[model samples]
Target: MNLRRLKYFVKIVDLGSLTQASEILHIAQPALSQQLMILESEFRHQLLVRTKRGVTPTEAGNTLYRHAQIILRQLEQARSDMDKSSDTLAGKVSVGLAPGTAASALSLPLLKTVRARHPGILLYLNESFGTTLSELIINGRMDMAVLYGDHASRGLSFQLLLTEELFLVTPRGMPMPDGPVALATLQNVDLMLPRPYNYLRKYIDDALAIARVQPRVVAEIESAATLAAAIHEGIGATILPDSAARIIAASGDGVQRRIVAPMIEAPLSLCVSDHLPLSEPAVAVYQILLELIADLALGSQPPEAACAAGARPQCPEQLP
Candidate 1:
């Protein structure tokens, strides 16, 4: 019933050992045990099951743990917000970005914007695969993450940033269609893409399956930069979002075409764990990224204008 006692109980569940939690909390073991017993008595339920291995939470304990995480996170956020200056905000924010998302689009712009605007805040960016980034966010290792789906996981809340169309990227000057390319046309094309489990790869595979088109996959890759470089080197072609293909094409070695006949658009989404409150600094970065995306959208020209010159999203080598 006591918040402080409940806080300690959550730590015990997290660390899986009361003794370890006691050491971290600087509370004597007997005192910690006494408070836990009192808490259990107040709740009138067996919150934890203890064995020689360690402690695990009961169903009721798990419920309390979830609520307690949100409570504590909110408490911390409130303290941070109060301590921040009216003119400037300062704190550490940890954000995870899926590999292709960061290298191709978000990372540099995010970093530059944060530096120019919230100079006092320290931003920690972790780049990993989508599933790994999702895990990091759900486990509280990262505050928020950018993902590529319209739907969110059980405990995550997602904001749709924009709908991004995927393009077929090839070596420069590769002959392609004059207009939108058919999805079935990729059947004979050699592909360099991320592994099957990757978000983009899975989407492409599913699309291909639906179209009854079996692509010739040459390599299973992880990094977007590598995927682009491989295609530019004539190793294979790849399917990429317009922004990513824009960055690659801007380098002057890649040519891209918009996929058609049931166009595939990977939704750019922002995901935050619903089980925890966002920190003040994380909130600032979130707003900034949203603003940047909005600015890019507003700056977009007409299709003819975009195509006459390559009008890639913000990167602008322009692939219509």
Candidate 2:
């Protein structure tokens, strides 16, 4: 397949008009149309349907567009890796940290270590929802991500980092078990939780379903501040990973207790693309992250305590 034709098709689809794409690409309208025709002939499918106002991608065109985006990005990454100076490892590396998970705490350390050790590298950090981050990796927009779940995803590779024990957090002074709270104990407890799609929520729901326990869900909240505020206002209790629960409990908004009887644990994984290899700068950052994890022993302690014990600079802010 001609790479130039793929580029032309993508631009045409993006602008929704061949004429607009020709103008932007500095190609004559007829030349651009010929390229599109060649692409269609190669695929043996009508890639686009001409409408009165503009062009719309057919199903085949949409599939091709998705693939072309990944291909183009990978090519650009290859060029960037080749252009880097041999003396200094330098380039942009994008990493995503899923919100509300233990991995979110690594953002600061990752940034600091990269700057000190590999000053030439530019680190781009994304704190977004787990699913969105995974999608970005698959699309070649992000290099890697540290997020919850080891579930198999197409075009993605996973490395088990650590498992976070879930805790039931209640408003301060609320009556709760001294040791571990059982899933059945939350049957009548009003719960505030993230939406069902959230990885944390899915883990909690799966465990509850297995235990045949149904807790009354009062609201769905994705924001950490809002959830903490709601808990302080006595709206409802919530479940969270140990790191996050400890932070909220430490802040005096809630009291956290380990969940038991059927303990729920969220598995954290290092997610990268199976098809796209990491660039030099990305690999350097990856190694630093693993070293940080080992040094801080984040698996065994709350992030704050781990940071304190490791004598590392505190994170600038808590990731949502």
Candidate 3:
């Protein structure tokens, strides 16, 4: 298969419009259609189903699209590797950190370290929901991400970085137990939690069910700022990882109490694509991130010293 034709096909499928694809690709519409026809003929399958709205990929086209993305991404990495000098690494590296998790604390350090070590590398940090980050990583749009999910997820390689225990964060003026709070005690307390689909939420739900405690959830918040504001305003207490709660704790707007009698914890994993190889710049950043995580003593933190470290509240809005 011709690489150029494959590239054109991928673009057309992405845009879902031949005319739009032609405009972006700087090729005539007729020429683009001819190229598409050639590709379909080469594969001996009708790749797209065209309608007045736009084009939709057929099963064969979808398969081709996935393979093409991998091929093109690998080709770009090959070019980058070949172009980079032995002494200097230079390119764009995108890393995603799930909000409202321990990984959020590493963002600033990762950026600073990347700049100090690889001056030529342009670092792109995405503080987003876990599922969105996972999709981007799998699609080759993102280089890597640290988020929570099943380690068994297909099409991704996982490294278990750390598992941070969840803590109950209560707003100021709200009275709570002195030390560790049990899950049963939160039944009467109004809660601000993520939607049911979130992994963190699910963990909380499972813990609650096991403890036979029913919670009074007031709102479902996904944004870090909104969640923090709500907490400061005394809207409702929320459960989050120690790192996440540390953000609220540092603000003096909320107090962190470790959840007990069935503690809740979210596992943080360093995720990368199984099909796509990391570019030179990405590898450099990846190594820096691993080193930074190691230095933070993330998973090894003692229960009594959980809130000893301070962090900025970048609570995850949505973690699919």
Candidate 4:
């Protein structure tokens, strides 16, 4: 069926009057009626039932109308997408990063890349706890996120990035306890963790629970800088991915120790809403962000080792 005809039919069904539809369409009532006749003849079915008040779609017509609406919508979307694809990628892309993800390393590099490669594209980077970011993405406020594993499945699609080791961060002067800290030892530590509502907190809480450790959370702070500062100021020790803790340790503010005894490696994922059809800019951002995460996993500066070596922030360029 012609898209033009489908549009006309849907409008007629919506207004419930051919005269009104003709007025809206700026077409003669007789011409509209003739088109309707041709459509009914082509289908060999009476599509609309006429009555004193107006016209209503028959069962077959209603079905066709529903399908027509979808078809018309798809065609409109196709046109919109084609218009976007015709030029250099240019649109606003919003990406969410949890406090524990190393957003600094990726944010600038991503902006730079978009500026250089797709000058029209603007990158909006949002930093929040995984729980908050997940909510934003699910509700369509944000487009995508980098999140910890346990938070992946609530109506969101996930692409596994890496399973990076977790670390116990202590004050700068605290003696590095030789090597990997056994996870069981965390039972006695006073932890300064993110709030209970944070996905990172949930992930740590569940793992510690399985280890049968009764965590002593001395404080809760959502900002990574503040969290690291707390540990540096000796407020309390806390757990974080080596990637997250690396910069803090390099700044000589905190010390990081790998967690062992059924190694605490939190799986990181690139997350997006399962229901939303990704736009061109969103897809570009996703691929670029994914590459950055992949670099973290396979790069020469292994997070656990990098922090110990006093390496600077692991930007994409610095990675092997």
Model 2 segments beyond 4 Å from truth? Answer: 1-42, 48-57, 250-252, 298-320
lDDT of 1 by residue, 1-320 (tens): 57898789989999999889999999999999899889889989888999898899999898777677667666766777889988988877877776555222556677888999999888888877778877767756578877677577787777776566788878875667777889898888888787777778878888888899988998987765676677667787788777677666666388878888768777666778876767768888877766655555555432321311222233222111
Per-residue error (Å), model 2, residue 48 = 4.9
**How high a TM-score does candidate 4 get?**
0.65
What number of clashing residue pairs does each candidate have, in the order they appear? 4, 0, 4, 0
- Residue 127 lDDT in candidate 2: 95
Cα lDDT tens digits, model 3, 1-320, are 89999999999998999999999999999999999999999999999999999999999999888778878877877888889999999888899988887677778878888999999998899999888888888778789998876574788887776677888999987988699998999989999988897778888899999999999999998887888888888888999888778886656488888888998867777888886778878888888877766556533333422442532222222212
Q: Model 2, range 1-320, lDDT digits (tens) per residue?
A: 89999899989998999889989999999999899999999999999999998999999998898889889877877877888887778788899988776667778878878999899888999999888998888877788898888886898887776677888989986777688788888999999888888888999999999889887999998887788888788788999887778666666478888788799988777888988888888888888776665554423443443521212222211111
Candidate 2 residue 161 Cα shift, in angstroms, is 1.0
Clashing pairs in 1: 310-317, 310-318, 311-318, 312-318
Ranking by TM-score: 3, 2, 1, 4
Please list the C-alpha lDDT of all candidates, in the order they appear: 0.73, 0.81, 0.82, 0.71
| Model 3 residue 226 lDDT score | 87
User: Would you give me the overall lDDT of model 1?
Assistant: 0.73
Candidate with the larger lDDT of 1 and 3:
3
